[model samples]
Target: MERLLINIKISVNEKIYLKDPESSDLGKRILKHSIELIHSIGFECFNFKKLGKEIGSNESSIYRYFENKHKLLLYLTSWYWGWLEYKLVFSTNGISNPKNQLIKAIEIICDVIREDSRFSHINEVKLSKILIAEYSKSYLTKEVDDENKEGYFSIYKRLIIRIKEMIGQVNPKYQYPASLASSIVEGALHQHFLREHFPLITDCSDTKTTTSFYSDLVLKTIQK
Candidate 1:
């Protein structure tokens, strides 16, 4: 699994960018510094000019990869989903029990992220924070319908589908596996945000508690 993840090349939709960021060193530097900029300032405030200054490049260089900050956000978030799906596969490999696999999947999405040295340029921890604070913006825009048509969200949707399949295996009679699966992922992010800003709204104050809350929530919802 580690070998697979290290070698995994997650393909992003061509429509999202003018050029592939993984295709060259400059492009990879753009991703590396862009992650730092977004993690420091935020998605709303991050722009190509700022990123260019941070990476010691011109705005045109950044534009060579992404058309706009929105597309860049899409790329980053899409990459994260693909990486997460990889982790999900790795975490659940050879686990025949569907319930156990489902539990592990929940934990992967809900728990604190550990930095993977394999992706040295991409900080999993910072990316996870961006996901918690900014993932919705990637899809909440008016262009989402058109982007969806172009498979911009294929990786994310695929992850949800994988977990939805596990839910079906656990509870063959459960009629809302898709909805339940999506809820688990989105709810985990929301719960994380609440834990940080509105602690009283959620029971997730730390990694262990957050993992327990989500794991129990999914098990009870599907297994009941």
Candidate 2:
């Protein structure tokens, strides 16, 4: 699955569209079209010709911005992370203290999962499997680095660091929770969004209310 991820990275730049939101650049125009197409038609149903027609561009023009569909999917997913990171960073303001920051961290991550239906757009485990497949098939492009997926990773690193940091602050000598505190919280959150929401409309295992219940449990666990 990871191999599929790397196999898909065709080179393109984000600024091609941002340079001018209106009639600015071919690259930007195609990128904007690509995102809208994916969101509207979904990953499985999207096609270049249909996308180009909708955007009033030719198929080759769309391909000029992205080599193919899968690569576009990768870029779009990464783009979401960029937007998310911006919100999270500003929301938390970089608190160094662990306990004080943990709540902010939880709020930042959970709020995104709950309020945004974006998570429902793709299956994370399947994507993770695809990421693993891509790694198996080939290596990631060098350009896909710190900025590429920082939004997704930074949240994980921040929580883990703060988990241990707060554990220490609360206990003065904290051991990593036997449960691996970070994963427990993240896993529960994932379940609420990924499995709990729908009977068949979603992969969610339980029901939508699971989020509220999980939130309360997490709060008590982290309470000082």
Candidate 3:
């Protein structure tokens, strides 16, 4: 899978960035350090100046690639989802059993993240941390409807659709496949957050527990 991913591009929507970070070294540095800086300082405190200082570039240079930090956050989150969608598709491609395929999808979505060597400039693990910590900020905005119309969230919505179809395959009569699928994806992130900060309130203490909880919930909910 890693070898297959080496050739993959994980494209984000063109409107999300002023420039493609993968096109040059400075652009890649912007993405690399931005992820590190955001992971280290949290997005509320993260800014282009801090990212530029970390990457040894002027703040203006960073702006040439991303108009502002909010757009940069969108680029990062969008890239992360696109990358995960690739993993989900590749991982579940040939599994013939609907139940087994859906199980694999859940596992991939809820599993603990590790650094993927295929994309060295960006850290998958830290990116996952950013997703868990700050993904909602990408779209929870006054302009979200406008951005949605522009297809800024298409990759994420497509992922939900894929899971929804798999759920239907598992149980043809299921009435709320889309809701259930979105819940699994969004709920997995919420569970991870709870496990880290509000452990007393969540049963998912780690990846295994989290994956198990969702797998059981989905199977039972859609059982014929």
lDDT of 3 by residue, 114-175 (tens): 88888889999999999999999998999999999999899999999999999999998999
Model 1 misplaced regions, further than 4 Å: none
lDDT order, best first, reads 3, 1, 2
The estimated TM-scores of all candidates read: 0.96, 0.51, 0.97
Model 2: how far residue 53 lies from native, Å: 1.3
Clashes of 1: 0
lDDT of 2 at 2: 28
Which pairs, if any, clash in model 1?
none
Best by TM-score: 3
Candidate 2: Cα lDDT at 28 = 51
**Per-residue lDDT of 165 in model 1:** 95
lDDT of 1 by residue, 59-88 (tens): 998988888999999999999999899889
lDDT of 2 by residue, 1-224 (tens): 32323323222235322232223466555556655555555556778898888778788776655666655655554443443444445555667765555556455544424323233333433433222223212114564454345442343345456555545554553345524456544454454444434445443343334334444555566454
Off by more than 4 A, model 3: none
Model 2: ten consecutive residues of lowest lDDT: 130-139
Q: After superposition, how far is residue 88 of candidate 3 from its true place, in Å?
A: 0.6
